[model samples]
Target: CSSCKESLEDQCSSINNEDNSTINNLKEKLSLISNFQEINLEKSLTLAAEVGTALLQENDELRQQLHLTKFEKSFSELELEDQLEESSKKIEKLINEAN
Candidate 1:
């Protein structure tokens, strides 16, 4: 009976030790997952900021191009008006000479 009791106690101890090891491994895995999540969050924030900056720069460039196009259009209109006025004066002069 004593020998049987000792064998049971030894078996119980072995099982308890294995349970403790499994719990420790699970805790380590949880810690690693938590660390990875934090890193991913930081990377996501950084990427968002970079994309925002790029979008702002693109917006500014588009606005500048729009302003330049408007200025060119205004200049072209003025040039056409000048040419029309000169042609009209020439036609009037020719009519007067004909008279």
Candidate 2:
């Protein structure tokens, strides 16, 4: 009877140890998952920020290009007007000389 009792006790202790080991492994896995989730969140935010910055820079470049185009168009119109005035003056002088 005493030997039987010892055998049962040993079995119970072994089962408890196995359960504890399983519980520890699950806890570690849970912690690792939580850390991974946090890291993923950080990476997502960083990527979003980088994309936003790139878009902003692109918009600024487009605005500058549009401004330069407008300036050039205005300059060309002014130059054409000046040339037209000079031609009109020349024609008037030629007619006066003929008369």
* Poorest 10 consecutive residues by lDDT, candidate 2: 1-10
| Overall lDDT per candidate, in order of appearance | 0.64, 0.64
Candidate 2 per-residue lDDT, tens place, 1-99, comes to 346446555655665565556556656655665676366676567655655665565566556556655765676688799999999999999999999
Q: Name every residue pair that clashes in candidate 1.
A: none
Q: How high is each candidate's TM-score?
A: 0.59, 0.56
Instruction: Report the CA-based lDDT of candidate 1 relative to the real structure.
Output: 0.64
Task: Point to the candidate with the largest TM-score.
Answer: 1
Q: Write the per-residue lDDT of candidate 1 for residues 6-68, one digit (tens) a residue.
A: 655565566556555655665665566557646667656765565566556556655655665
* Per-prediction tally of clashes: 0, 0
- Candidate 2: residue pairs that collide: none
